[model samples]
Target: MRLKRKVAMALTSVVAIGALSACGSTPSKTPAASGPKKLQIFSWWTGVASSKALNSLIGVFNKKYPGIKVINEAVAGGAGSNAKAVLASRMEANNPPGTFQVHAGGGTLLSWINAGYMAPLNSLYKQQGWYQDFPKSLLKMLTVKGNIYAVPVDMQRSNVLWYNPAIFKKYNLTPPTTFSQFFADAKVLKAHNITPLAVANHGNWETTLLYSDVLLGTLGPTQYENLLTGKAGTSWTSPGVVQATKTFLKMMQYANTDYSALHWQQADQMVAQGKAAMNVMGDWAQGYFTTALNLKPGTGFGWAATPGSQGTFAMVSDVFGLPAKLSNKTATKDFLKVLGSKAGQDTFNPLKGTFSPRLDANTSLYDAYSRSAMASFKKDQLVLVIGQGAANPGFTQAFENDMVTLLSSKNATAFTTAVESAAQSNPL
Candidate 1:
């Protein structure tokens, strides 16, 4: 369930600038020059692939700028909630790290921006010509009141279904294209004693995927946004939303008995090992595919969005927030330049199992799914996931909790009530 890495385990700490002088670890003479300083970067990158991605980017930075060293101070956490708490404590103490991971969305880094805890990147953005490279949808996420507060690293498609291709072929099943077709296929899978949905409910993010797919499939893109944005009331009891819940309940009924105890990797393994038929997860699950299971993306497994979705995609992005204290400073400016540089994005994203933030990234370096995601981004139909769409972490987790309770209990009325509660209590 834990996704972030232990910084102490993976990283060798560099002595802080002032600490070098305190310990007499610096060169002889005038009290240790703190010019073009080393950066202590904090992140929640735990997996081997994730660690490799961060270290690969650092390797690039090491070559390009010999003066600045990036000490990656990673922390093990649950989908970044633990990291966020630690980051807040540091900011409260007025001792923030040089950089930390944040999502590109209205509520993620914008609060820090508005509170003067994060730096604006207008100058760096313009200097690096990022305005032309980043997508408009991503730009909207990073911008707060017309000021850019974060740098987007990569994008992940939230509404993806990973299925065992061999199972599909043996069962003579084609990927479903509509909700009705999906349900029909589920029956076929169940008749053969196959678990249609391989889920890991104990991991909160895994459950959130179910809620997103249902909401998006039921409400479609436009109404889903309206509901999340508070433009419409929770009419969760509405035919569409309720029907979606029931539909999801049907899928859940076919789940393996140990779903509640499994982690994401275990569910992915179930499909990979042919113990299950399908999994609904974000695109990054492919990392567990190619690397851990030695499976190819399209050959060993396959990808498709939820049926009846009309090409609508759900997403959340990994973005970097610069501390407000460093915005106008020359040293921080130099670091941000490297961060948004072509080489920086190139080295970071492909290896990270996500699409580059810059629209101009060389797609040749990515695998099949990453390439498809980039192509999908160009179509401009991405809808922000519900958790990432909320204005606060409280709302995000509450929505996920309520949905989990609702589906786990198999009560449509209770689920609708929970949605109504989320709508009124959270207020977007």
Candidate 2:
């Protein structure tokens, strides 16, 4: 199904206001009712690690507001494709949940804001002193026309390369930091009858995600951002895009033959079981490794920035916003208060395998991998992840479709042409 197409249709009004800056009036607050209420929290976080993290956050909310009942409306599959479809239906029917998880960016959250489906949280942010808590860059992402629409809970680094330490050591190999070194390592691994890279395209967005990293690694962060933002000198068919696409196609040669059939978690499992030497995925794989596979960090697995992407952090954040016209507005605000709290973020992000977007979160609660990521998030150049929340839904949909075709055709020229056309139609 064309999931992003549905999203684009639902949020068609976003295009008109896409270029507007973050400036707007503050919304008035709604006082809490004195009786018990039920709040439905919606998301696509049914996986073992994500589900556990959600439960922990809900448990905190429950303890604080015992009079409110939280209903988890989590739908599984497609890395939120299924959940987005369900959410769109509920929103259209005016059966919006109390609050729902959304990615923090113009392409995702701004669509909901511009469509008038979300409530501005400026008053809430002021009440909670969140302006100082979250980083300026993060809050900026959730803002449009001076109104902040969502509260980001966690920060995940998308440009991560996870490798099996045992497999690397057995081959006397280390993580590669450049494409030349990556191919060299792949050659060695392949000679030993090992899959060099573990990949999964079940959701059709994984390869697109990989290509985003390849773009950043190839063009550097500035040019990559320029291309996405439709800068004057940058174009989708530029030499950098061509090189990145070629690199992406070459990397696929080292991936598993069954990549089309496996889920993302299954691809992570390939590295866990030593069937594959490496996988390039978001740091969420850290949660699956530690929580589901019972593997320890540092020794069990090693991680690095995707080849040539060092000193840059590609981020995908999961945020929640107060939907407009909710009966449990007070309860939802209460939940948002907790969600954006330092205590709540510290409780949730440790188990979720991500860093809290709040700058002052307790670092001791996180693991070695997460602590490292947190450090990078603070000092490195940050970029939004494509196919997650960086680009508009129309472009994201076209990009995913093009990646799927490139998998079979391996036609780099055709890939660039299609993507350039998508950029023109979608306007970034």
Candidate 3:
């Protein structure tokens, strides 16, 4: 077996190193192996919760493939920007990891799939008979030209409005279900010297995440989808776009001071600590509440879909893809098997604070918030996170820059015009 040979070579190398150590000589720092024997999986999940979730799956993966060492090559940064930059460098030099993480939908990273840098996993999906296991709609998102490029690990709902229950009850304020209601509550919260909304523009992507929810809440799902796919002339100068911009500005007026100084997690922590009334962010904040903050889900916090977006689920699926022409194909494929399994989903999703993409995953393993999320997923129209998921990366970046400028400018018309220009200049 290949594993047996690898073990033999390692033992011999260790003995040789021991012999050199006895001579007061330096031993080689390189791992002595016949060939590639480790599976390096790179991702932005260097944070506590996401890392724990990935590690839980690794625990299962080790049971399945004990011979292969799973290396956790995590790069820490918000939006995976730091990791994305590093990945681009590695991929440019044809030195990619065994596998890397990406989103499952829209124009995000479509170039890599189209460029043939990713191996088509269609055969693997067929071998596992997964055609019916995953939802057809989800498969549609991951597939291009009849090939599935990656395996989705979990589904995260992005448009959730998280709030402090104790704070809301203390102020006799119910969670807002519409923008009008949100503004009304903002007034009351402001009167009490409490920050109404918590937003962190530390990175462009977090602010984009916040604004995308407002875009969805304003334009609704169908129009939003049109904008992503560049249908219906899809210019950002549209009336709906203007309305969304205005709405975003209005919300910004209530946000915490020096918001750009905090990261997204710190904004969520404000809600968890009852220092702020609410935070409109993705469900990862739940993982922060439970895993890091050691707080109960429904008891410690409250959640609803972002105002006026009740029937839509703004989603981001964290997916993994094998590098092109992998040296350790067998190990990477075996890891992919774990990524797509119900058992793997069960172990990973609960800890990750996201729901399993698999319909058959054991829901019992998820928390109360996740169970509700899972239920809503089936009912809500699945809208992609435009800034991070649906739109082209270049366009998304430009849009983020426009949005950040708009935060200070408060010039909705110029913002919309700049966004329209960005949309026209970039390819979908």
Task: Arrange candidates, best TM-score first.
Answer: 3, 2, 1
CA RMSD (A), model 2: 10.8
* Per-model C-alpha RMSD: 8.7, 10.8, 8.2
Q: Model 1, range 1-428, lDDT digits (tens) per residue?
A: 13345554344344464566667742222322556566777889977778888898888777877787678888887877788889888787666778888776655576677679987888888878889988776787677778888777777888888899998999999888777787787889889988887999776667767667877888888887666666755466777778878878877777787877999889989999888888888887888899888898888989888776657768778777678654234545565676677788788887788877677888998998888878887774767776554445666767677776776578887877776776677566
lDDT of each structure? Answer: 0.76, 0.88, 0.85
State the lDDT of candidate 2 residue by residue for 1-428, as single tens digits: 69998898768757545534222212332344555587889999998778999999999999999989999999998778889999988888677888998887757677788789988999999998999987787787888889889999999999999999998999899899999999999999999999999999887878888899999999999888888877887788888899999999999999998888988889999999999999989888888898888898988889999999999999999999999867557889999999999889989888777889888989999889999999999888878878879988888898889888999999998999999999999887
**Model 2: colliding residue pairs:** 22-145, 22-146, 23-145, 23-146, 24-145
C-alpha RMSD in Å of predicted model 3 compared with the true structure: 8.2
Model 3 lDDT tens row, 168-201 = 8888989998899999999999999888999887
Candidate 1 local distance difference test against the native:
0.76
Q: Could you tell me how far off, in angstroms, the CA of residue 281 lies in candidate 1 after the best superposition?
A: 0.5
Whole-model lDDT for model 2 versus the true structure? 0.88
State candidate 3's TM-score.
0.88
Task: Give the range where candidate 2 is weakest over 10 consecutive residues by summed lDDT.
Answer: 21-30
